[model samples]
Target: MKKACKIYDEKTIGKFVDNELSSEKSKTISEHIETCPICDSITAKYNHLSNIFVQSTSKQLDKIDTDLLGQNVLEQIKREENNFFKKVFDYFSPKLYLKIASIVAIMIISLTYFQERLIRPLDIIGPSAIVNSVDGNVSSVMIFETKKSKHTIIWFSEA
Candidate 1:
């Protein structure tokens, strides 16, 4: 035997208004409402209320895009993360300091290892002397440049 028709609640009628009921249930409700004046009236009220609810919230509903909004938020987070990482990299970069220190160390090492070659030319001499005799005495004179001052000095001696 077929089961008796079930009375759907107002909420279910709201679902029917939204076309959410199964095909069989929707046909059954439609047939039942024709013979039930109370259900027919309730269904009408539910449809009216559902339409009003949709119309009232339609503007806000149209403005909402959860996917686009979530993507925008993720993009903002990525931008902020990139900025933070850039700041951190700038703070910790060692190339400049390392290059400067390396150059300075190389220069110091070269200077130390080639001190003599750097200070004075290999062609430079230490000193020179000239001697001459006048009357019965001999006189000698010597001249040279000091390493520190680069000035010539004359020494005179008589014997």
Candidate 2:
């Protein structure tokens, strides 16, 4: 009499039929499936399901036109890029646009005036004065303003 199989579930038979099990285990399951009518029927069903799944998926992929889909995406991106600025401007009236332009002009004029009059150019602004005296050996004194902080610095050297 043939030895009875301990494993009879559909998962074990499916794994055997799909060649998912180790070589030795797959051989053993294959032998058992041949002898056991119930396991043989279950393996047949799993094979049918696997074949149907692969065929249906491939058919769906063949139905789509990849080149046409790619062109539609590219055209949409170009249309959005050309229309973005126009859309923002369309939200405002012509009178509002003039008002915004004038405000920006006034800000630029004020900044220019302050930069010319209040902020002196670095190259033109130098040491205000220098004092030097030799009491016994040697001594020198120089006074200048810091460029960034506008604080006065006095340098003295004696040798």
| Predicted structure with the largest TM-score when compared to the true one | 2
- For all predicted structures, in order, the TM-scores are 0.33, 0.41
Error of 1 at 81 (Å): 2.0
Mark the regions of model 1 whose C-alpha exceeds 4 Å error after superposition: 1-22, 61-75, 83-159
Candidate 2 RMSD to the correct structure: 17.0
For lDDT, the strongest prediction is 2
Please write out the lDDT profile of model 1 over residues 1-159, one tens digit for every residue. 723335766677767777898999999888988997767887887778878988989978888877788889999878866897776765656898768778999999998788789745533454333334335354876656677545557666878
> What lDDT would candidate 2 get against the real structure?
0.74
